[model samples]
Target: MRKSEYRISELLDRLARLNQSELWTNDLNPAQVAALKYLMAANRFSRAPSHVADYLGATRGTVSQSLKTLAKKGLIEQIRSAEDKRSVRYDVTKTGHSVVAIRTNLDEALAQLDQNESANIALLLSNVLHSTLAARGGRSFGICKSCKHHDKSANRPYCRLLIVELAEEETSLICHEHDSAA
Candidate 1:
């Protein structure tokens, strides 16, 4: 690998180590916390174990295990989907929200950056991630607001892909079907 690539990899490794060290105070493992974080940010439509697996690029079995653990901890609840009773949805409970709300070392570090610096860093990382995912033929888990399928013509925005009028709260969420807006 090139020097820049090696540096990037090292940086990511250090970040992961920092996360592990910082999050050790919490009872849950890194995977569980990641799931909780994903659930907290995901839209109502993307709250299933399958969605989590897809987003994390983890196996279905692993995602199922993680969901089971979260449910056992009362951090998340399983409910029959309102639209489809056969399908089950996962939702973070009040406790789960509180758990995920606790700031980690990475969060604290990012908070130290100025608004402009943060935005720039985010943009740079996003570009890197987008390109890397595309190269690997991986799904780009993009935010709904920047998706091509987000129809803003109506007074209330809707997702053309999902064929449902989106709630105001859902507009900023990460969507499984998200496609980048040109």
Candidate 2:
């Protein structure tokens, strides 16, 4: 690998380890915290266990365990689908949002960056993530508004792929079926 690429990979690894270590606060482990955060940022259609697994790149069994722990801690609630009893949706609780509201060191560090620098870094990282996921045959799980299926020209935001109108708030949340407009 090129030296720059190697350094970037090393830096990402270090950042991930640091982030994981810091996630042990609020009586939650890293996995549970991650699951809760995903639930908080996910739209209604993408809040299921399967979607969580796909987003986290984790096995269904592992995601299930983390979800169970979150539920046990009263941080999240499971809502069974009325149309399909076998299907379940997860929602972050008020307590969960409160926990997520607590700022982390990473958030503070990012806040230190200038707006332009932060935006540039986000864009570059997003490109890297897209390439990596493509190479690995993984799902993008990107924001609904940035997806090719988003139809904002209509009176209401709509997802052409899902064939349903989306709420304004839902357009900003991540989706399991996201296909990047780029």
Candidate 3:
């Protein structure tokens, strides 16, 4: 690989590690905190344990144990899916939401960057991530509204690929089946 490519890769990997370097003083482990944070930001369609495992690239047993611990700590609650009685969904409690709000040093450092620089960095990082995921045959977790499969022409915006109607709030959330509009 070229020098620039190597530098970019190194920078990204270091940034990711640094971002996750600090652990909160709370009772929850790093994995549990991560799961809660993901639940806090994830769309309704992506609230299942399976989806969490997929997003975190963790095994089912690991995710299941994390979910149980979170539920026991009152950080998250498991609810029966309205559509399917057998299906279960996870929701982050208010405490869970607050747990993830404990800002890290990484956030403070990123905040030092100007708006233009932040935007440019975000765009560049997103491009690199997309390219890498595509090359590795990994799933894209982009917002549904920004995906090529999103159909807004109908009365309700829906995913052409999943054949499911989307709620208004779901448009901005990350989708497991998301494909880049570009």
Candidate 4:
């Protein structure tokens, strides 16, 4: 790899490690924390265990175990899908929301950056992530508003792919079926 590429990869690795270290709190491991955070940011359609596994790039078994631990801690609860009896969805509890509200060192550091700098960094990182996921044939799991299926020209935002109307707030959350407009 080029020197710049190597440096970028190394920096990302170190930052990820630091972030993971800080996630170990409230008697929860990094995996559980990640699951909770993802659920909190995910829309209703992406709350299933399968979607969680896809988002984490982890095995269903691994995701299942983490979910079980979260449930045991009262951080998440399972809801039976009314449309599909066999389908189960996970929702973050109030406790989970509180846990996610706790700011980490990374958040504090990022908060120090100016808006322009932060936005530029976010765009660059998002591009990198999209390229990586494309290469690996992984799901984008991007925000609903950024997906090609999102139709905002109407009175209400709708998902053409899902053939359903979306709440204004749901338009900002992530979705497993997201197809990037880019």
Candidate 5:
């Protein structure tokens, strides 16, 4: 039997189906959910439109529209940057924070729910994501590079998880599909 690779879309679909838990009780659409995810994953969602632009791989206009929609829904609040009032920063509101936290924790719990069969694989993937974030120089306080899980070895720079075999020249790049920790 040949091992198969999973597309991100497939994983997302699985997650979506299993996401029956009302972690985020708010009645948000897909775009809203994505906005919230971006905020939660970003720097406490305390940046301006430009910051969102980089994180979401979106343009300022798109982020602006989403921000506007979130703000109108009272799920988030926009505060003008004190240093640069012209710049607006978006943060979760009281309700927003609650739901965001719920979703975040529920996601963890769901992952933990599979503690029997393939839990190891689930756990390994989590580690890979953490290390990838670190390899990019993200910080725990900011991006992924600042994480404690990040590892930099002569064999795998900025990566602690031996997800895959490293190449001779770019020994740092690991096979994302392989879940072995070297």
Candidate 6:
């Protein structure tokens, strides 16, 4: 097998070292990871629970389990959707935002590092991480909804994600890149 391809089982073994117990000691669990991962990808906006589950590579039961813990901690709250009466979307609380926002500094650093990092190292890291995510059909979901270029027009907003017109009320997620309204 190519060096880029580590057998699937071996991949998790290497990644497991990066996992920490502190999160669970404080009441977090794998389920919360799924929900949080979903919210992280969803931006600050809310999304249907089913979408969260699908993206997390988890079952509805698992997403529901984690959402309960997150809701109890006030890290996430559910809101009814105008588009679908039976559908509910979850929004991360400010505290939850803080938890995810901590990575902003890291992103900024990476943005800076990209200026000089050799192509070889970047490629290697990307390959390793991408391999793992691709195995599960997961994606980092990086884009400009988190960027300063995004704007809110009235209740709706326009975004770079698609050329079509949009609204703040329409956006399901906003990343760190979006600037607060001036």
What is the Cα-based TM-score of model 4?
Answer: 0.96
- TM-score of every prediction relative to native: 0.93, 0.95, 0.84, 0.96, 0.51, 0.57
User: Taking the tens digit of each residue's C-alpha lDDT, what string does model 4 give over 1-182?
Assistant: 99999999999999999999999999999999999999999999999999999889899999999999999999999999888899999999999999989888999999999999999999999999989988989999999998999999999999999999999999999999999655
Model 5, 1-182: lDDT tens per residue?
Answer: 22333566477567666674443357665556667656655542235666665555567788788788888988888888676778777777877666666545446756666566467766676676567656874332333333333445444534344343333333322222223332
Highest lDDT against the true fold, candidate: 4
With candidate 5 superimposed using the best TM-score fit, by how many Å does residue 47's alpha carbon deviate from the native? Answer: 2.2
Give the lowest summed-lDDT range of ten residues in model 6.
17-26
lDDT of 5 at 27: 68
What clash count does candidate 5 reach?
12
Q: Which candidate number has the best TM-score?
A: 4
Question: 94-174, model 2: which lDDT tens digit per residue?
Answer: 999999887778889999999999999999999999899899999999899989999999799999999999999999999
Off by over 4 Å in 5: 1-3, 6-9, 16-25, 44-46, 101-111, 114-182
Candidate 6 stretches with Cα past 4 Å from truth are 7-12, 20-22, 43-46, 101-164, 167-182
- Model 2's alpha-carbon lDDT is 0.93
Q: Count the backbone clashes (under 3 Å) in each candidate.
A: 0, 0, 0, 0, 12, 11
lDDT of 5: 0.56
Off by over 4 Å in 2: none
* Local accuracy of candidate 3 as per-residue lDDT tens digits, 1-182: 99998997898788777767675448877788888888887877788898898888788899999999999999999999887998888999988888888988878988999999999988988888777777877777888798999999989998889888989888988777777756
Please state the error at residue 105 of candidate 6 in Å: 14
Cα RMSDs of all predictions? 1.5, 1.2, 2.4, 1.1, 11.2, 7.6
Model 6 TM-score relative to the real fold: 0.57
